[model samples]
Target: MSTSTAAAPVVADERVASKGPVAKLLGRPEIGALVGAIALFVFFAVVAPVFLQPSSIATVLYGASTIGIMAVGVSLLMIGGEFDLSTGVAVISSALTASLFSWYFSTNMWVGVVLALAVSLAIGFVNGWILIKTKLPSFIVTLATFLMLTGLNLGLTRLIGGSVSSPSTSTMDGFASAKAVFASSVNLAGVDVNITVFIWIALVAVASWILLRTRVGNWIFAVGGDANAARAVGVPVVRTKIGLFMGVGFCGWILGMHNLFAFATVQSGEGIGNEFLYIIAAVIGGCLLTGGYGSAVGGAIGAFIFGMANKGIVYAEWNPDWFKFFLGLMLLLATIVNLVVKKRAEAK
Candidate 1:
């Protein structure tokens, strides 16, 4: 009896093993982004002699870090079947808010930091709440926020800082510590690596863990796949969306602080149109425009590709105007590749 049972399980395991690793990898959401990134790297490396230089790599990573931070946030939210148009201006809004408060009260930089975080979180909450309450499309809801924040950023900066940009907070109290936390750099192999790189990496790690190892992650996929179906199955769609947006707000705070401390001043007019880059990076990372299929690491890889192409064009001495053309072409190509990959993955 025991021997018969052992062989039964063994045969089942052997049969499952026949699927092969290639098929398994192809099924993963990140596969397309990974392949595209590799291809792009090779293309640039061949055409741009200096693309392989140490400092050049650092520049690419730095650019990725800046966009990657937000990419992580939007990726998570996108995986939950939503978009946040306000994200771009929200970044500038937070920076302006922090700088204005810090300058106004002559308080510790942390004071402004804390207040700015609160404000950002509130903005996220409002965006989510309004969407849920109105039953409108997220695109419409967040577009309104984008417009509102764009105005408030400019208006508030002028009202408080008396200029289109916030006053410098470089010499404010607690500036040094804040700088260390948000804007400091470390020497890595004789190359200066911004602290944002570490932060972005950590975020990707945590997000991947959340999406893969936690119950919340399951809910995210389910909700994005179908909110009504997820809710019927007892998933809290509202909280999940609200939390996702709040997560975006949290990243906004981090990036905003970095902007403030890195430059010591905040430009209210900055960050407009940057949201498109974040969305594009996330899309390129394997997150579907329709939602419910993506990964945090994919988002990072997508940003890496963006960063590489950004600097690679300069290194290749190509016209900057052609960058968008490359992006559009890549987007179309990647989508087609991913569609085939997903179909293959689900075929079994």
Candidate 2:
């Protein structure tokens, strides 16, 4: 007798589920920051009418760009699971290097600029190398670098320049050209917007692309998530970390050039605590302290929020003294919101 066996039923995999658009959007690390930015913008617009003015908007953008430039690198470094406490002083050091070298040697400003770039990259390499070799926490490694650089910035400037600041480089060869590239401004709809703003935008765009679309980006996430696992999977953990630190140095070099060209002098004492601002911006942008998550866009939004709060207080005619309190509150609230959003997304 011929008997036909019943066919087995097809079963869909329970582990895979199709996510809708809303779920996908919420899944982004920057989503909470985006919401916060919108709220902040509205609050400022309502409280300070002048904040909406074109000139005021330009000022806000200028302020944002300054921090945002460094935030680009700082955010990336955070995502790669590391910190660079030396960044603040490193910037001033770069500017000082360019200024002192050019003025002392009576050479072209370009020469000093190139030399400063080398010095900055070397500093990054040293920091990374030490971290890799010693397996010390990046915090300690960079903190040591920070202290050393702070001392060097002051001691060297005093010894070489005979003062706490470098000599004026406005008349040096290539000074004008460099200034035009780094410190010039553009007129947009009757408002002057600093060149650094455009540069910051370019940096954000490039960094976002690198983080989202390249093999290097994959390696970054992999290492940040778990260095040992990443190494086991053939990722270049050492190179990636070193490259990230170098990226921070590159950013420092750019900002340093801007400062020197913009003012024609470098103050050894400047940029002492600005590293915290960069780190705060990255954190507010949704980068976890533990790392392995965050986006360039989120950092940009964080910087924008900072600009608003900084300028908004003045526009509202409030006491500037309260700005710090406001900042701290924002930081705490942002962190909580980010954590909540992350958990909710994961649940989805």
Candidate 3:
């Protein structure tokens, strides 16, 4: 048996009869991120008078929704001990594919969306399969993918659409319905909330359930924590990792659709550095660099922190150049804090 499985009962014994509430709370992967988020929110709200306004709230939610969608997937994959540097470019690729396909074929918009989904999932599978087969580091594998997708995004758009951006899909058949579902906003007591906010929230809920309640969740944690050991204990390590990558692809599809519908066009060269933002959010939200422990809710909280900081910087009248500085500072701080928390959790 794997070390984790062998020690499961001892941990359960501690859980049921030894560790108190304080220890339990300390063991939570998201606790540090949660605390940090609250602190960041308060700091921003106190300084930026408009930070708490309804419109500002909506803006934060919209921004968070974009990154949060990807953060959840990244967090899960991180828990599985891998990274996908191609995610940002992949989003653009998916969007471009959908827009161009729908326009060229004169088909229903949904057809293009489904095709995009298939393409994204296939890319994910290739990434996962190649990594497992070649025994390569995920960083190297995805870095190559990132570069390839970047070239493809620009090259394919020019070759097929004669521009750096795909043609507007706003007028395509079924676009209105797709927009209403993915990009529309609803008013709540005069405050407009983006539909993506709802989607992000639902995704968090579902991901949390999967992580905390399902057998697959345990498998994910096991594989990330120690793949060799997990395999020894009968975990399908390869399948788990591939599924995690595909989950990321699924989120990329969702975000791609939203981006295309929201702006009515997909830029071939868009989404270059945004992968860093998603990773930073996941890291800030409590996913460890070594993986094996993290939370979906933590990632959501991290995205919220990013959304708030992004707009809060503007609202506070800070120089735009400092945004990257702030993000990097947060990432470092969160990583240090997560390490300390992990130590505490493992301590008796």
Candidate 4:
């Protein structure tokens, strides 16, 4: 050759490309939801002047916290690739368990609380166990659970409490203490913010940490991405999935307790369709129907969006009937945006 010297081969590392801050931001699962939340906030601020008031904001946050608390577990379960159609009824079931047991047994309210927890965890365990054994889609498994719990909630409440609602436990031992923990409010800058808001924030922080920092988090993502592949690689697919379901049950328990203490009674039919709301929040938060991609923070944002829309309509004095229509529209739009953002992130 000319100089009998060839330049050493130059190998390009495909994975070494540096992503700018904007690129990184666009890569986040919740970025789309964040943008949507901001736009919604501004839209409401323009149309509904009262929405910006501290009192109204507190109310909005309270509503969001209720949904967001459950969204935490729902988000994680989704990340692990499963669904629980019984979540709505499951919550009422837990509340009913505590109220009925305490009122009937004439025991400390705390006793029923502990028992309710056991029952809740048991329901989740059964759902998981059946799924693992039968290999049925989560939909069928939880739908069966949904129906069973629904019947039991109504039938048992009527059988024991002699009504469609649980008996009032407001006078029971520990009622005051339990209510303080679950339903009380904190005065923040003169606004009475519900205790649930703090609980919701704590849950999101903890869930986010698990998903981003821990081995279990990795297991969740791995199993959700490809259970067969993850299993081949030594991931405990069965355990992860089951744990996720149980996590959902735990969340239902917390919310159920809140409902019980906050109101002292729960309607057997109260939670009938709320499972869809939880699913909608998760989906709007960037979770995939096919699973393996989402965040707790995204779910919180989704819940915030729901809170805004739900109250924004009232503030703006629009027909309340239009809410479902707006909810559907937002869900469709958010899903599309999340998909587009994900595609772009992958391309980059």
Candidate 5:
């Protein structure tokens, strides 16, 4: 009897030992993001002495804020097992919405803001409705939406301004508040830091809260982990997914409003090709392409890395063309490492 009890205890210990490595790997998904950020910073700082300058750092933070905001939203949706390809066009459309309202109607800035957000949420619902109802892959559904919105953005900008290349915001009224929220700078330790940075910070805080502290965050994790199981357990998987899609659109709109207010002008084609960048940032932040796990903070860090590399290279007097090459390398490396780690974790 004593021998039988001893054997059972040993078996339990073996099971735990087998899971130890896997547990370690899954401890914190953001570990890779931290390591990548540090590694890149060290590499760039060593190779380019100007990489750590105060102004250079500020520029990196500012340039990354808009995309960082979008990436955070994408990370959330990815965590819930969905994707939004229309984010790029959504960004332009949101900005254009605000721009047109302010430009033509002399509408209240607040009204333009409301309209931009509402339009994005409406589009998100449409995307969700199509994907959930048809049981179609979100990738294909959003891709179609992406093309459609792109065409509309371009056509409407031309219709409004009579020219695509020089989209004008001069006629936009109540530009002051928009600038204060999106473009205006506050003196931070003697540095002129754009309000967009604050927006990024606020977004991170809110996203982290929603993802970590709220029940909705748990649903996001569960829905991504296993949608069928989540639904069986009473989770509203479709609604949750639709909400995430809307989050992406909202992020895009915020960025659009920021641009419209900051420059008081925007290219009709602006934000085109930017959707991929947001995805890249989210992936680098440790959001799995296949979904289930991600970090809002990781997304922010990823954005910082991209922003730093883009501006840091320029400040260091390096060829701007090298930026694309560097970005490609970063994405490839992150993907490879993430895959290896994911496989190892699953192996147990």
Candidate 6:
């Protein structure tokens, strides 16, 4: 009887397997990003001679690590049907907060790190709370938080250091643990890769597993697909959204830590403009701007593309100023392609 029951299930699975390649591909959103990344690699490899170099590849991956870290979190939050504009500003805010604590109080580096994360989480809670409580769009709520955090980051930095850029000496004197975590790099294939690479990779792996293998992942998709409908079905929509917000905030805090490790001095304005880049990378990697359809790995791949373009252009001796033009073109092309692909998917 058990064998017969198992045989019946196998027959049902065989029926689904016969649905065709398009069905299988549609069932897995990650395939789109993978295909896109491969295509881009082929394009660059064929046309840009420098792109194939080991050094060039290392540069791309290294640059991608920082933004990719945040992209993973934003992708998860986007999948849950929300956005956080304050991400970039929060980076600076956290860094400066950490700097202030370690520099002035002579506190333990880990304590300052904890305090920075807590501050970021508090901001995230406020963002989610205001949105849920007031029935406002998350975009509006987060935009306000973004602007406020930007101001706070600059204002606080100046108040502390009397300038926008905090000096390096202050950081070195105070944060020993921060230095060990953020500044260390591992040598790989003659390339000095930051330790943050492992962190980003780990985050992507964990996020992908959670999304594909866990019950919480199911709830994330359901919430993003339709919050009201999900709530009606007993999904904890509010709690889910709040969790996503906290995830974003935590990502921002990690970014600050990574940046501090990379550059000992904290710059108030360094990360303020990165908000759009994270969104663009996520969108290009297969996350829908409209929400509910994207993978964490896609976001990482998107960051890889950005990093490749940035470093490849410079390595190939192209003008750095052209980066802005390239970014605009990329944004336009990716959006158009995504729309076309989305239409075809919907039509089918």
lDDT of each: 0.90, 0.91, 0.89, 0.92, 0.82, 0.80
Model 2 C-alpha lDDT per residue in residues 1-348, reported as the tens digit of each score? 112222325454445465789989888888877888889889989999999999998999988988989999999999999989999999999999999999999999999999999999999999999999999999999999999999999999999999998989899899998899899999998899999999999999999999999999998888888999999989999999999999999999999999999999999999988999899889999988787999988888889888888998999999989988988888888889999999999997
Give lDDT for model 5.
Answer: 0.82
Note the residue pairs that clash in candidate 3: none
User: Which one wins by TM-score: 1 or 5?
Assistant: 1
State how far residue 340 of model 3 sits from its true place (Å): 1.5
Expressed as tens digits, the lDDT of each residue in 81-175 for candidate 4 is: 88889999999999999999999999999999999999999989899999999999999999999999999999999999999999889999999
**Segments in model 4 whose C-alpha atoms lie over 4 Å from true places:** 1-15
Model 5 ranges off by over 4 Å: 1-26, 165-167, 170-172, 342-348
TM-score, one value per model = 0.95, 0.95, 0.94, 0.95, 0.89, 0.90
Poorest 10 consecutive residues by lDDT, candidate 1: 9-18
By lDDT, the better pick of 1 and 6 is 1
lDDT of 1 by residue, 1-348 (tens): 344546675555433545678888888898898999999999999999799988898888888988999999999999999999999899988888888998998999999999999999998899999989998999999999999999999988898878998888888899999999999998998999889999999999999999999999999888889999999989999999998999888888889989999999888899999888889888888898878989999899889988988889999999999999998888788778888888888987
Error of 3 at 227 (Å): 0.5
Question: Candidate 4 local accuracy as lDDT?
Answer: 0.92
Residue ranges of candidate 6 with Cα displaced over 4 Å: 1-9, 12-17, 20-23, 169-176, 345-348
In candidate 2, stretches whose alpha carbon ends up further than 4 angstroms from where it belongs are 1-18
